[model samples]
Target: MQSALLVNGTLISDESVRQEDILIRNNRIISTGNNLSGQPGETNIIDAGRKYIIPGGIDPHVHFALPTPEGCSCDDFHSGSLAAMAGGTTFIMDFVTPAPGQNLIEALSLRRQEAESCLLPYRLHVGLTWYDHTITSQMQQCVNEEGITSFKVYLAYKGSIGIEYHELEKVMHAAASLNAIVLVHCEEGDLILKKQREFVAAGKTSPLYHALSRPPETEASAVKKVIDLCRKTGCRTYIVHTSAAKSLQYIRAAKAEGLPLYCETCPQYLLLDESVYRKPLPASLKYVISPPIRGREDREALWVALRDGTVDVVATDHCPFNTFGQKDKGADNFTLIPNGAGGVEHRLALLYTYGVLTKKISLQQFVALTSVNAARIFGLFPDKGSLRPGSTADVVLLDPDYTSVISADNGLQQCDSDIYEGMPISGKFSVVTAESV
Candidate 1:
């Protein structure tokens, strides 16, 4: 059996941080406590002095090898997973978006084949792009046979991937019956499409107009609608990449009423704002993400939500498109720009510097947001999120004193441009260990 011991490290969990030594046998953690000992020549001992040993991060959202009108996303599963591991993330949950008329199980199998090159353990949340009487049975098959427990439905890309509220209600009902959670991209598609037409007509087709078209009201309205549906159906629902403050009020009220509504905000939503769209040409185009980055007030609201537990997880909507070929394809028009940015390789360092060091959130809260909460919410729990005995031996050793600036040239992601370029960050990973399952 493969065995290793990690000693003299401060172990961080969702509830607390304390010095503990962890013993691993094969892929499982054998124990975690003070002064753990292993027989000489039988086990390898590794020192983790002055480091914070925490559960490996689980990014609950990412798009690898995603096919769009322009082309496939720059980073495939292998490259994206490499970037994830470089940033101390051990497990990632990506979506399996089915094509029109594609069977959910078949789509999942195909996505699994594409993800075979991924370096770390991963799971998929199947997308319900189109609805029919057969969907309910397919969802059950996915849960029982495929180990997929989450369903993603978009309310943004209308006529393509997005479904109407009535369709969403059906999906919610089906998912609720199966005890599965629904992940929603909460943007009013009709409103966005109307605005897009207006912008293009007036010749306001810049990236700035992209943000202007999808105002906070659109997201807020969709959030409100989704909350109402959750109350009606009693289905657990999660809002993905919640970008506006107005949206949180509805989520907070839903949760207050004990509704099974969860919210996720990305680093871009919390740290970057609408100002990026105001920058020059191609520079502005990269920030043209869906439910575009909101204003400073929304940014501040997200930070407050993170501190107060309104936000459940901080995942990177890590879809990357190169500026030269992908993003700039729509240089004369904003809608054609593939909406995504890369941050999987910098989520930990950026959050550690801005979130933990700045006191916006505590170390325990940091652990929860980055790894623990995601694990618990997504049903990975002790196996992937905790350092408890019998858990998967996936750990990250963080050097608190280490500091560096983020640049695309040094990043592991295949993309040529980074949204967080030139951002200075504190703390770096000293060692990241993930025992393959």
Candidate 2:
């Protein structure tokens, strides 16, 4: 690989930002300091004038090419990785969900084939859908041989993928034994099912009712359950795509008690409110995700969590479905709507525009939430989330003054509709480099 020298830019990290030059060689950062030098004509030299160079983002929660009943999510690894690179995310950690009767290793292999078209280096978080005696041995193989240190479990979607509380405890016990982290989708399945039945009985089956079916309390209740289980099992736990204020309070309390609890909220929950669900049918259906987009109070509370350290990272769930062919399949029933939104291509710019520009968080906090925190929590660490010497040369050059109107028309994903259409954004990724791994 060709080496390069990046000069005259501000280097931003989780802790600080400083004007520095960077030398990249053999897919790793060889040096970073003031007035970095390189042999003329031997190394490529690029000037990042008036731009901020930060670690390429690491999205810890994504479902690229996720299979659904009707078909697959709109973005496969090919298009998904393209979108991620455009948004300055160079590495992704996607889930490996086992189909019914499939082993964890088989699921991992299948997902690897699905992600073979990926343009960036990626990792897997094996989702433990069902538990068997053989699962314990499989979990060990995944951690030791596959180098997968995280596992995902859902508390909703009961029959399809969700596991019971006892099963969750068993999974945590195995993960703890291997010192692996467990990521949970915390929404009480029974509560959601009960609400769904009530809503259907009341003749309220529109997209708006999707949010009503899975209330904030459902997520908060499940979050408490998982935390308590993790506490008892001594397993490190991460709550994924947390979207409720009450859940944040529980996570904060758990952390205060010295629990190794970490949680992440998506940009959708931070920027869009449940009010989107009240929009026109086609429009609202785009935001019909699990533990759906919450109200303004929850959005505000999520931002506060990021500011106050109650939340550790910001990730885009990045599961996209087209309105015409994909999401519209559920027009008659909200429950059938594919639950996801397109954000991998817009995460960094949106966060910079909304969080950093509005002064809700500092630039340092922005780096922490977007890159470092996820890296540390998910075990990517100094290699993927930092620009330090010896780290992977995954860097993004952002133009703080770049102006653009966000739209799916210009986005790189395979998804059809743009949820953030016409929203004005200030910063843009001018240059992105994802070195080969």
Clashes of each: 0, 0
lDDT of 2 by residue, 1-437 (tens): 37788889899998888999999887789999987887676677888889999999989888898988968888889889988888888888899989876889889988999889999899889998887678878999999989889999999998888889998898899999999999999999988988888988898988999999998999999999999997999999999999999999999999999998998999889988888888987878788888798999999999999999999999998888999988999888888888888899889999999999999999999999999998888788889899999998888898898889987787788877888888998888744442322
Clashing residue pairs in candidate 1 (N, C-alpha, C atoms within 3 angstroms): none
lDDT by candidate, in order shown: 0.90, 0.89
| Best lDDT among the predictions, by candidate number | 1
Report the C-alpha lDDT of model 1 over 1-437, residue by residue, as the tens digit. 37778888899999988988988887788999988887677677878879899899999999999999999888999999999988889999999999987999999999999999999899899999988888888999999988889999999998899888998999899889988999999999999999999999999999999999999999999999999999999999999999899999888888889999888989999888898999999899889898899999999999999988899999999998999888999989998999999999889888999999999999999999999999888888889899899999888888898888999898899988998999999887644443222
User: What does the lDDT read for residue 186 in candidate 1?
Assistant: 95
Give the worst 10-residue stretch by lDDT in candidate 2: 428-437
- How does residue 173 of candidate 2 score in lDDT? 93
Per-residue lDDT value at 28 in model 2: 86
RMSD of 2: 1.8
